[model samples]
Target: MTQPVTLSVPCPDRDCALSLARAAVAGRLAACANIYGPVTSVFTWNDAVEEEDEHVLTLKTVAARVDELATLLQTRHPYDVPAITWETCSADDDTLTWLADETR
Candidate 1:
């Protein structure tokens, strides 16, 4: 049984977010990618505090492809240390089946 997963990634801007989303879906690495934001993010980097607007890219995929999806983000993401993370999600059987088929 394939388990559904949602990967969350923060992008510096909208274009970067869209690019990643497109790449993953085009390659069938993800069933869907939702781009959200222009949200404000405040974090510390290199011993300094910083605040910036960023877009959040959420990808829907399966457990089997999570690692590959992460690798793709790592290689293509603009941020040096992209915060690529994911969590398991529960979906209806039909949605799950669709996700699996679309990804494949």
Candidate 2:
């Protein structure tokens, strides 16, 4: 059985987020994607504390496809160092089946 996973990628703006989501889904690297916008983020970068508004793009995919999806996001993302991370998840059977089918 394939494992379900969720990837969280923070983008500099809404357009960037939407572009990543569209490309991933269109390429079947992800079953689906959700974009949340204008979230305040505070972090340390370049040895300095920074704060900015960003969009959180979440992708639903199988573990097997995560690497490809990450590569795609990295290549297209606007940030010099884009934040990309994933987590394994348990979903209901129907959802899991749908995810697997869509991704494949």
Which has the greatest lDDT? 1
Lowest lDDT block of 10, candidate 2: 74-83
- Over 4-87, each residue of candidate 1 has an lDDT whose tens digit, in order, gives 999999999999999999999999999999999999999999999999999999999999999999999999998999999999
Cα-based lDDT at residue 19, candidate 1: 98
Candidate 2 to truth, TM? 0.97
- Model 2, residue 80: C-alpha shift (Å): 1.5
lDDT of 2 by residue, 27-81 (tens): 9999999999889999999999999999999999999999999999999987888
lDDT of 1: 0.96
Worst 10 residues of 1 by lDDT: 95-104
Off-target runs (Cα >4 Å) in candidate 1 are none
